[model samples]
Target chain A: MIRIFKIALRNLLRYKRRTMLTSLLITLGIVLVILFSGLAGSFKAMMIGQITDSSLSQMQIHKKGYVSSIDTMPLNLTLDTNKYQKIEELLSSNTEILAWTPRIKLNAMLSNFTDTTNIRLNAINPEKEILVCPDVGSRMTFDKGREPGTLLNPGEVIIPEKLAKGMNLNIGDPIVLVANNKDGSVNGLNFKVAGVIESILGPQGKEGYMHIKDAQELLRMDEPEVIEIAIRLHNFDRLDKVYAAVSSKLTGFINKKGVPEFEIHTWDELSPFANIAIMIDFMTITMKIIMIAIVLISILNVMMMSVYERIREIGTMSAIGTSPSKIMSLFLAEGLLLGLISAIVGNIIGLGGIFILNIYKISFAFGRQENLLLSPTVNITELLWVSGIVLLIAIFASLQPAYKASRMEPVDALGHV
Target chain B: MALVQIENVSKIYQTGDVEVAALSDINLSIEKSAFVSFVGPSGSGKTTMLNMIGCLDMPTKGKILVDGKQVDTFNRKERAAFRGNVIGFIFQSFNLFPVLTAYENIEYPLVLIKNEPAEKRKDMILDVLDSVGMIDQKNKFPDQLSGGQKQRIAIARALVTQPKLVMADEPTANLDKQSSINVIRLMREMKDKFGTTFIFSTHDPRIMEEAEITHTLVDGKLT
Candidate 1:
C-alpha cells in the first residue's frame, strides 16, 4: 500500500505545473471557507453577546399571556407578591442561575415642565438589574457631575438618549413621571435625571429606567408586583438545559384556574436580532457548499486528465498483473494526497489570516452599538471538519475517472499509439 | 509436459458491419524452458497468437491451457491473477513506468502481485537486475537510460516474478541492430538461468534465427 502511494505521489509530481495549479485552486477555496467561517462566526457571537449582556438577559420568565400583550403594558397581568416570592426561591436554589432580577414594565407620561411625552419605563433594583444585565450600566452616559458606572438611585431616573435630546433634559435635571395603577387610580413622582442610556435597537427606541421603590410609590402598589423576570446563566451555551430545568421545576406551580402561570423564553425567542444570527449561519452554509463544488470540479477535472494521459501506463500496469482495484486505488491515492496537502496549506494560511484580523482588531457597528471589535477565530474541531469534507469530496470526485481507468482492456489499451 | 498447449484456436474480430478473421484453426504446443519465436509479416496474427497464449485475449473457437490450467475459460479477474502469478509480459516499447526507477520497475511485480517480503524481494530484484547486466543503472529512470538499457530493465522486470513463461510481442521492434542482439541475448540468458520459457514474435529474420524453435505463420496459418 505504501509503495503504491509512493508511486501515486511521484505521478502527481510528474505533472508539476498542472498539479500546482489544481492544488492552488483547491487551497484558495479552503482558505476562503475558513476565513469566512472565522469572521462570520465571530461577528454572530459578538452581536449575540451584546444583545444578551445589555438588552435581553440569557432568558426571561413572565406571567402567561403577558408577552402577547406586552405592548399594552398591562399592569393587571403582573405576577403577584406570592408568585414572585416562589420564583425568587426557585431561582436562588438553581446552581445554573447566575443572577435574576424582577422589573415592573409600564408606559408612563414624562413631564419636563414644558414638554410632556409618553415613555416606556422599566422599574428595577439597580444592584440586581446590573447582575442580570452586566453590560446595561456600560450603556449609560453620565454627565460631568455624575459617576460613570453608578446606575439609578432611589430618586433618580436614567432617561433615553432621544428623549433627553428632544426634551432638552440634562443629568441632574428634575422630571415628573405620571402613571395609572391597576385600580384606575393615577399618581405621579418627581425625580432627578441620573444619566442618559443608549439604545441598542437604534434611535427609534424610547425607554427609560427608574428605581423600583419610586415606581411602586408612583403606582401606589402596596405589594411588589413584577411584570417580568430576567435570568442570567453561568454559561450561555447551557441556556437550553437551564431553561428546561427551570421550566420543569416551575411546572408544578398552578394558578387558581389550573393552568401554568408562567412562560419561559430564551434570549433568542425574545429578540429579533436572532434572525440576523440565523441569516449569518445560512450564509456560512452556502459558503461551504461553494467550497465543496470548487473541490469537486477541480479534482474531477484533474483526475480525468491524469487518467487520459496515462492510459498506456495503466495498460502496462494492468498487463503486468496489477489488479483493477489497485489501479483504482492508485488514482484515488493521488487525489487524497492532493487534498490532504492542500488542506493543510490552506488551514495554515487561513488561521494566519484570522490572526492578522485579530491583531488589527477590525471594528464595525450594528444599529446604535458602535466599535464592536471582530475577534476572528475558529476552533480545532471546525477546522478538522472543513478539511475532512474537502478530502471526502476529492475522493468522491475521482471515483468515475479511476473506475474508467481500472476497467480498460489491456489489449486495446496497449494497442494505442 | 508442455508449458503451453493451443488446440484448434481461432479468433474473429468484428469491425462495424464486417467480420474479420485474425486467426483460424491454429494448433501448437510449447515445451517447458524453450526459447520459441513466432515469425510473420504484418497482419499475419503473430500478436494475436501471443495474446491468446499470454491470456491477454480469448480464442473464439478453441481452448488454451498454460501449465495445465485452462486459461481461455478464466474470468477477467482470474486472468489477471493468472497473468500476475503464472506468466510475465514484455512489450516492444520497453513500457517501464516513467515515474519509477529501474529498480522500482523491477520490484513492481514482486510487491504489487507476488506480495513478496522485502528481504526476499530485494534479493530477487537485484539478482535479475544483475543477470540482465543493468544492475548499475537500477537507480536511473527509464528516460535517463538508452533504449538498450530500458529493454534490459524491462527484461529484469519480467524475470523478477519467476513465472513459468514470459511472452514478448515484438520485443526488438524499437531497438537498433546492436541493441536488438543484446536484448535477445539477455532474454536467452534469463531463460537459461531461471528455467523460464520465452515466447516472442518478430518480423526480423536475424532475431528469429536465434530462437531454438521458430514457427512461421503466413495468412493466420502456421507452416
Candidate 2:
C-alpha cells in the first residue's frame, strides 16, 4: 500500500505542468473565497464600529411608543423626572450597563443670518455624553468660543460640522430654532452656537445638541420628558439580556402624560447601515460559492484526466496484488496533497495582497470621506474557517476520480493506452 | 502434484449489445516447475486463459486450482494475497511504471507483498537485477533503457515475490530479435534458478520452441 502511494506521488510529479495547472485553478478559487469573505467581515466590523462607537450603543430605550411614530413627537408619552431617575438608577446599578445617556430629541429648523436647515435636536448631559461619544470633544473648537472640555450653558447649541459649514456660522453666532411645542403651538427661540460635531451618521449633518434643561425650556415642556435613552453595555454579547431587562423595567414606568408606552431597540435595529453590511455579507458568501464551484470543476477535470492517463499503471499495480481500496487511497492521497499545497499558497497570496493594499494606504472617496476598503484585517477564527473550507473542497473534488480509478478492471486497464 | 488444475473453465465478455466468448470449456493441467506456453493467432483466447490463470479474471463456468486451492472461491482480498504469494505477471508492452527507476520497478513487488526490512529489500532487488544482468541500468528509467533492459526489469519485478508461477502475455511481442532472445533466455535462467513455473501466451515460434509443454488454442477452444 505504501509502495503504491509512493508510486502515485512520483507519477503526479512526473507530469509537472498538469499538476501545476490543476493546483493553480484550485488556489485561485480558494484565494478568491478567502479574500471576498475576509473583506466582507471587515466591512461589517467597520460599519458596526462606526455606528456603535460614534453614536448608538448596543441598545436604546425610548419613551413608550415613540419609536412607532418618530416623525410625530408623542407628547403624551413624555418621560417624567421620577421615571428618568428610576431608569438611570436601575441602569447604573447593573454591572452590565457600561453607560447611559438621557436625551430629549425633537425636530427643529435652525437659521443663521443667511441659511436655514432642518435638524434633529438632541439635548444631553455633557459629562455622560462624552462616555457615549468620545469624539465630541475632539470635534469642538475654541474658534466657536466654547473650547475643548468647556461646560455648555443653557440656550447654547452645538451644530453638526456640515451644518456649520453650510450656514457659515462661527463662535458666538446666534441661531434661531423653531419647532412645534407640546401644546401644538409654533414656538421659536434664539441660541448661541457653542461648538461643532463631526459625525459618521451621513452627509446631511442634520443633528444638533444642547443642555437637557435648556431644550425643555425652549420647547416649553414642564419637566424632563426624556424622548430617547441610549444605553451601552459592558459587552455587546449581553445585548439581548440587557434589552430584555430594561424593556421590562421601563414598561412599569408611566410617562408625564400618564401613558404607558415605550420601545427597546438594539444597535442593529437603529442603524440602516447594518442592513447594507448584511447585503455585503450575502454577496461575499455568494461569490465564495461560485468560486468554489469553479475550482471544484477544474480539480475534477484535472484528477479525471490524471486517472485516465495512468489507467495502465493502475492496472499494473492491481496485477501485482494491490487491493482496490489501496488504489483508491493512493488517488485520494494525491488529491489531498494537491489541496493542501494550494491552500497554503492561496493563503499566502491573499494575505500578501491585503498587506500590499494596506502598505500603500489604498483608499477611495465614498460620498465625501476617503475610506480604506482593504485594511489587512482578519481574525484568527475566520482564518481557521476559510482554511477548513478549502481543504474540504479539495477532498470532495477528488472523490469521483478516485472512485473511477479504484473500480478499474486489471485486464482492461492493462490493455488501455 | 500438478501445479495448476483447470476443469472446464470458460469466460464470456459482453461489449455493449454484443456477447463474445473469449474462453470456452477449456481443461488443461501442468506439473510444477514446467516451462509452458499457450500459442495461437490473434483473438484465439490465449491471453484470456493466461489472465484467468494469473487470477486477474475468474472463470465463468468452471473451477481453477492453483497449488491445489480453488481460485474461484477466493474473495478479493484472498485473490490479492494469492496473486502476491503464488503468481507473477509480465506483459508484452513492458508495463513498468514509467516514472520509477529500473531498481525501484524491481523493488515494487517486494515492498508491496514482502514485509522484509529495508536492507533485505535492497539485497533481494540487487540480486534479481544482477541475475537479469540489469545491475548497470538500475538507475535508468524505462524511457532511458532499451526494450530488452525494460523487459529484464519487468522479469525481475515478477520474480522478486518468489511466486510459484509466473505468467507472461506476449512477453516478446514488442522486442527485436536479439532483445527478444535475451528476454526469453533470461526467463529460462530465472526459472532454473528459482524452480518457478513459467507460462506464456504468444504467437511467437521462438517461445513455443523454448517451452517444454505447449498448448494451442483457436476460437476460444484448446485444439
Tens-place lDDT digits, model 1, residues A223-296? 88888899999998898899999999888888899999898888888778788889999999999999999899
lDDT of 2 by residue, A28-133 (tens): 8767777676666666676575567655656777765677676665555566787678778878878888888887777788989577888787787878777765
* Runs in model 2 lying further than 4 Å from the true structure: A1-8, A78-97, A109-118, A136-146, A149-154, A161-168, A176-190, A198-205, A217-225, A233-263, A371-374, B15-19, B74-78, B110-120
- The per-model DockQ list reads 0.87, 0.62
Query: Which pairs, if any, clash in model 2?
Result: A64-A261, A64-A262, A65-A262
Candidate 2, residue B55: the lDDT equals 90
TM-score to native of every candidate shown: 0.97, 0.88
Deviation in angstroms for A116 in model 1?
Answer: 0.7
Worst 10 residues of 2 chain B by lDDT: B108-117
Residue A363, candidate 1: C-alpha displacement in angstroms? 2.0
